[model samples]
Target: MSDTPQSFENFKLNKQLLLAINEAGYEKPTPIQAQALPLALAGHDLLGIAQTGTGKTAAYLLPLLFKLKYAQGKHPRGLVLAPTRELVLQITDEVNRFAKYTDLRSVSLYGGVGPKSQIEALQEGVDLIISTPGRFLDLYNRGEIFTRDLKTMVMDEADKMLDMGFMPQIRSTLEVIPVKRQNMLFSATFSGRVEVLSQEFLEFPERVEVTPQATTAETIRQVKYAVPNLKTKIHLLEFLLRQQELKRVIVFTKSRKNAEAVSNYLGRRDLGEVKVIHANKGQNTRIHSMDLFKAGDVRILVATDVAARGLDITEVSHVINFDVPLIYDDYVHRIGRTGRAEKDGEAITFVNPAEAYHFDKIEGIIRMQVVELSLPEGVEVPPTPFVEKQEYEREIDLQKRKENPDFKGAFHEKKGNPGTNPFKPTEKKRGNKNSKAKKNRSQLKTQSKYKNK
Candidate 1:
């Protein structure tokens, strides 16, 4: 532990753990893993600042599993709480991989399915539990979870947890657990809310940051296309997918509606095995879709921001932003889906005039100016639909007004502002034009007053 280890064998890990780590395809530790492993194995409370796909799951798991060697107790000795069901499953997969050679027993609890199997697994026995906050709370409230033996607690994607309004559940969880334990919190970005959570969660913790907060991966080649309409965006996506090298791709949309539309469009176009996942999809359906994508059955997976944070599917060739994310931090997660495991990746975003404003915010958060590319030839850039154009204009106006309260957008210009609009008359001319109407209003007011009297 005194010197930096170039390989996994250099770490003070058990024979069984080393075997599992080797088979799991880990040669050397990721930056987060490298820094956090020693601190965590030394029984220090760890605060890991890392985005998704940085091998953070293993960062906490390696040290955690090393300590829980051979699984002695009936109740869970380690508990990892994540924001979404997908992430819980993801962490569970890694735990299984890393603990393959050990006698460790881990159970994953999530929503979308009945808890019968999970409760049965718990009743039998488990050394570790990976679960979503809501599902974990549900099980705990029903007297299903035994936390008396929980020596280590990990909260992954803490920032996303706050965004999803899991703070109350998280607070309740803290009260229920044993007062003394080793706590670890990992977040992609440490916003104010995450900082507050960290203050309450960690006690004299060792902070390990593998990357700057909210920064996108440098390995990703990012490009933005100024699309005029949804149809044009679809055309551009088709154009990109037509290329033979885009073997595995994930198209991230802003909503379930858009995800479905894009998926359906691709499916009909005979684009290789397209599937979509969002909140509207059943849990089983979503899981099945993810499995298909991971297994190479589905070449294209259209998703909303739900899959942005923690679902780890490696070697994803491209991440296409069909719509700019509403939350700026999500841009990091969306692109982080690619460029995984330090591999070169590509991210292409389709931004209309309305979305350009949000994309600009994304660039600001990532601290880099993304390259804007001209539309490829043969892809028809059709005229934007009237309704869509109006919506974009309205959105742009709202963004402008949000930034500057004094902004009188082109759509909302005062009718009498002469310089602002060529056809509009001066204020004096407007007052003169309405002078007769003003007198009529005064006469009506006097008549109404007399009537009241």
Candidate 2:
């Protein structure tokens, strides 16, 4: 046996949880867990900024379980808020696994499903609760779950929570929870919004940021391709998917429509077991689809922004950006799905020529130039030409004036002025009838001259 004590024992967890940890085969502590556990066990608020797949789930789950177990019967003693239903479920799973040997019970609350089941679970006064912000607040509003005795609150994936527009829900939830207990904020990327959340939620917390902020995981190989059009994007994606037989792949699209379209296209091509998950799908469908993907029954998963935040599938071998992520932080989280647990993985992003600006921002955040992937032969790629609308309009206006002989000059000039009359014969203007007679004589003279020519 190693000289170092078990992680559970080191954290001074109760024997039951310790037994569960050893039985679960957790020998060493992941970096985030190792650093954040001790402080959390001491009831101190902690800000843990680590990349995805660094065992952040266990980092908070292990200690929170111990805290709840140590102080039993404090109804709804711990609350964990995740940005997405997937992450909420994931946290619940981790807590359940860690607390298997203990009397610590946990309930999951999320949207897409009805509140009937969730309310029933809450009515039972569970020891711990993990939930998404919207569903949690919903249940709270219905008097199903209250924050009266909430001793420890943990926000998992705080950065993603902000990205998903959960700030309002999160802030309101914080208002209900007791301020006397511990607060922990964990995320893959830390932004100004995260700082604001920390200031509002945590009280002089110990900050522990393991990886460099604005950086992607070190194990992922980032690849970029400069494709021209949407059709070419599909062509390249098809070629790549065929070239490498990925065990489990995720294709990220910019919109739900595109995700469904991609899923349909891949399925039509006889690609192995393609599926889609987005807001449009019912909760049961999403949960079942994700479970199938995790079970390896579905090989490819096409998803929109909703699935970008909280997916924790470990077997995802490749992450392809069918549409390059517009937000810089999303790029980090997407690729993070792969290359987890120090496993080597590939992240290939399709960069449409028009989206080059967005790609530049993503590259700047990851702190490295993404390697360009070569396109298959005979593919036409379009370039985004720089055309200023204002400049083009000015040129078109000038051309229109040049083509029209009736165009008027900006400044009016005396027609008979010495310099202006160079091409005109000098003539005297007559008044009234005299002017008519003079105009008729000029017309007759011009007609006779043209006839002679």
TM-score leader: 1
Give lDDT per model, in order: 0.90, 0.80
Question: Number of the top candidate by lDDT?
Answer: 1
What number of clashing residue pairs does each candidate have, in the order they appear? 0, 0
Give me the displacement of residue 135 in model 2, in angstroms.
1.9
lDDT of 2 by residue, 1-453 (tens): 123334557777788877888887677787777788888888788999988778888888878887777435636888888888877877777777788877666889888877888787777768888888998888788777767788888998898888779999987987888879888999887789998989998999998877898678788888888876677788777877776557799999989899989999999987789989988999889889999999999999999877776666777899999987778788888888898777888899987654676788788887899999688785655543434333333444444465675654432245676376322445655466788898999999999999999
lDDT tens readout by residue for model 1, 1-453? 335578877668999889988887787887788888889988999999987788888899888999899878678888999999999989988888888888899999999899999999998889999998999999999998988988999999999999999999999999999989999999999999999999999999999987899988888999999988988999999999999989899999988898988888899887789998999899999999999999999999999999998988887999999999999999999999998988989999999899898988888898899999999999988898877887888888889999999898767765676457423434556777689899999999999999999
Q: How accurate is candidate 2 locally (lDDT)?
A: 0.80
lDDT of 2 at 73: 61
